[model samples]
Target: MRELRGPIGVAIALWAVVATLFHLYTAGFGFYEPRSQRSLHLLFLLPLAFVLYPAGASSPKDRPSVLDWGLAALAVAANYYSYAQAFRINLRFENVTPLLWPEIVFGVVATLLVLEALRRAVTPVLAGLLALGILYLFATEYMPGMLNYRDMSFSEIVETMYLLNGMGMYGSITGISATMVAIFIAFGAFVTGSGTGRLFHNLGTRIAGRQSGGPGKVSVISSALFGTISGSSTANVFTTGSFTIPAMMRAGFRPHFAGGVETSSSVGGQIMPPVMGAGAFVMAEITNTPYSSIIVAALLGSLLYFFMILVSVHLEAKRLGLVGCDPSEIPPWREVLKDIHLLAPIFLLLVLLMMGRSPHFAAFWSIVAVLVVSWISPRTRLTPRKLWDVLVQAGNNMVIVALACAGASMLVACLTVTGVVISVSTLVATLADGSILIAGILLMATTLILGMGVPTTAAYIIGASIGAPILIQMGVPVLSAHLFVFYFAILADATPPVSVASYAAASIARSDPMRTGLAAFRLALAGFVVGYSYLYTPALTLQGPVLEIVGQVLVNVLGLVIIAAGLFGYLRSPLPMPLRMLLVPVGLFLTLFEAYSVWLRIPVELAVLAGLAYWPTLLSTPAPVRGETTRRAESAPD
Candidate 1:
């Protein structure tokens, strides 16, 4: 339980800084070949992961034991062993490379290190899952039908997993971390360190604190703005929810509702772009879609998601008869703008991305931009010491993602080796029994399940590898299919039963965990429809003509409104239970953009409009809870 001190803490800090410098150097100056680049990246991260993350939950919190340091050194050395002989390994194109004893020993060590890292950083289930995959690799032929596989020798399995172009540990994902994701994450760290988070929080409070459901709306806005920068959902929650959740409670929201809003909105940051969660970078690489295209395709869905929360908050505010925070209590916009220059780096990054710069390039210069812009204000200035701490924090943040990506790449390699990737897809297709909707549901369920325990990048990487192929087989567009799985994976954090994010927010709000989770799920219902909408009609993903995209968006926007109103039982006034039930199907139908459904939508739209005109008469008089106030202060303050 002793805190890390003296040489060991300094060593760890230096190692992380060295790693950041390595990535910064490669990102700006020149790059290594893919294998070397990624191998070195993994080597840099392996030791840091061991030393930074505890070996177990019961392991030391502040200090590393001798054994822990030794293991950390070993993990780094193993990667260096592969990296040092990259040229010699590359020459052997086939799997017939002779395994020296060191190679064999290190191979086994590398496999164990990856599993241990996964066990430490992610869940034990994922680590066990990788162990099972490796077991399958060596003993597949001994299985029953449908679970059977072609057996490969132990050496062959080792070759494929550890030594084959470093595909297992140093694959596309590792490559992404080395080149693209690390830089963007570093940019995030710099932005946060330079005071952008405070600026955004101030702006959000000033902009949203007095609106309907003021504090909740402030949370939605701040989390969205902040999430766009950090791109990690849980981090987003803890960062902004610490403020927003408390504010919502004071604004009269139930503890559970406040918690649910924070969890749901923070989770939305993963789906937001141009600097989305790390998963977006991997998704762009895996799907062969340009990062810009991915961001463009995601724009509508992300905005609609925020819009849904906004509408729901407004309705709840109306139902509760809540009022905005007193102007005397709220921060003024002018005061918040004092740190406005802190936003230049963010705007620059977004502009460069829109201009089609590669993500790494945009991120590299944005980091510089943050450094440069921080000089403008004495209050936001970054000293060398401060900047060093930023890099260390960046490295610390990158560790979880590095471990997740490494493990994911290993699982990806395993599935590809055992041919299970194709089998799982075929099995999913079979489960669908030819209905694309059924196939979509099965894949959605799978991602959500994996997402319950896995980080977004790992869950999506695994799900897309298995499920996207099945969807493509069913004629779904490549982007739409990957987007579908990715969306559901992000949603998994808010989903009930095993949602870590909901639990995190529940703790903050002092609410029931399961109830918060359900509330989050209710608020996030639009996400499910939107995920499927892109697949049913590609226009939603920016795949079709401009007119088609606009028309489709308008229709779906209305559908989202109807869905939200129904779910919460309020629209201008409280909707009756029967009307609420009626709107669900109508809302769902409005999202199904196929020609056949258009016929149903037309009549449904007319009826909805007619209902709106006569809405006042539909309900019996003495409107329940009309002008109701959730809390009454008995006397005015002196």
Candidate 2:
């Protein structure tokens, strides 16, 4: 094992160097031919998958035995043969002839390789799911319900898998991954290497480190910034929670509360703008919307999510009598500025994106900017060795995502081949009976359920393919349909029973996993409002008139504050039960729907304000017995 390690590492290192150059030229400068670019993308995966083999196999039980290696080798050979056949067919323009022997051979091998790689990289559950999908595809004639289809010949299946058809792995999934997604992953690596992550953490700490429940609030803010860029809930939790959770504990928060706060905040990252995981890029490609618009919508959701967290933290602080960190302990402003240059890449990327450039170009240049800027400051300089390490690390990181994309592509291919997406869409529309509200709820549930175990990008892609069509057909705008599915897909990270983000936090805090998951759900209630609001208030989506948008934004923000206060059970002090319960429903109504009549909403709005104002006063005034005691004490003062 040790002898093979050196050669494998060297080979992986060489792949990184070549892939980096390829990405820079193709993604950065946009100079590669289409076929050449696709070939490079496929070749880049070989060394990456090999290098990750060891790390992904930590336990003896996980070690790939001789049989496993043989199967893997056979699979790779099959995949290559398939690609070669597909390339030939592309060259010939022969109307997808199923008599293609090379195509059949390639399909069989490629399927085996993907299934084995999935087993080695992800989980058996995913592998099982893929196997079931393939089996069902082959046995379509025997299946019942919407799943039944005419039995495809072996050549027909091979043609679907290998040819330049939409069902093949080289379609949209890999298309998006090789272009936009890969560039952004590189962009994130560049930014993290440049120390922008630390800058965000420091800024969050400086702004929110010295108030009641300050540490918890800081966690919310810092995790949001980190997650927005990193776009993985588990990564977000580990990155920001390491500091924020400890700080929250020191500031008198229970372990469970601290963990829940970090978990809930971190999960919001996949829905945050700019670098929002690989899903945002896929969202743009699938919906035909500008990447900038998706980023804006995600940013709105992120802002509302973090605001809810802040309000909850503030109320918790008041209830618990927690104090902020000492002023002397806060980092100096000038010191923070020393690392401010780290932010240049992100700002530059955003500006370029807003100016209508491709995300690939934006990410490529942003990476260049980070490397160049880091060289200017000795404190952030990346030496040749470090640069190589970064490349290797980036390549390694791309493997799981790349494989998942490949697997998801199969699912997409199957859906397209069977026309299952249209079938499912029609089924959902029928079930909802054309009610947008009912359709939205059912779609949301489907997204969250499917997304629980899958990566956010894969889940979002699948959800958008199956669910978005239904919503769009129901007269929902394109952006709203996509965004709605995307939001619920992200919510799966924090959703109960299988909340991966909450589990990460639970491990860190040594708290009960289920309890932390429940707490996270409570902390993230406002996200539900934001998700539903996208359906009702198109203005919040920047789709309507400016005045109407402003009004929607104002009402949404106000409603969020009220809901946060109610959920946390405190405004100025412990809210009386009656007012807390009253505010919860009122806030939900105003936040979820802008269609409420003025006459109906005005009365509820007035009642909410009255409750907010009177609750504190009612709590502050002394009882008659307490007043009598105070008078007696004054008369008998020493």
Error of 2 at 150 (Å): 1.2
lDDT over C-alpha atoms for residue 519 of model 1: 90
| Candidate 2 local lDDT, residue 335 | 71
Encode model 2's per-residue lDDT on 1-638: one tens digit a residue: 11234654486467766766666678855744444454356556643453346424443333444554565466556545544544565575533444556556666776666776666665455566667777767898887888889888776665565455444566667777777777677677667766777788788878988888888988988888887677678878988888888888889998888999998898888777788888888888887888988887667667877788888888888899999876765788997898888888889989999999888888888888889989877778877877877776576566667777767777777777777888888898899998889988888888888777777777888888888888777777788878888888888878898888899998888899888888888788878888887776677677767877766666777787788778778776677688788788878987676567434554566567666857667557665774788788889959
Q: What are the runs in model 1 whose C-alpha is more than 4 Å off?
A: 1-7, 596-603, 606-614, 619-638
Residue 299's lDDT in candidate 1: 90
Q: Count the backbone clashes (under 3 Å) in each candidate.
A: 0, 0
TM-score of each: 0.94, 0.91
Clash number for candidate 1: 0
lDDT by residue (tens digit), candidate 1, 178-209:
88988888888888999888887888778887
Model 2 misplacement above 4 A = 1-7, 31-36, 50-87, 91-96, 576-582, 597-603, 606-610, 619-638
lDDT for model 1 comes to: 0.84
Mark the 10 consecutive residues where model 1 has the least summed lDDT.
Answer: 627-636
Clashing residue pairs in candidate 1 (N, C-alpha, C atoms within 3 angstroms) = none
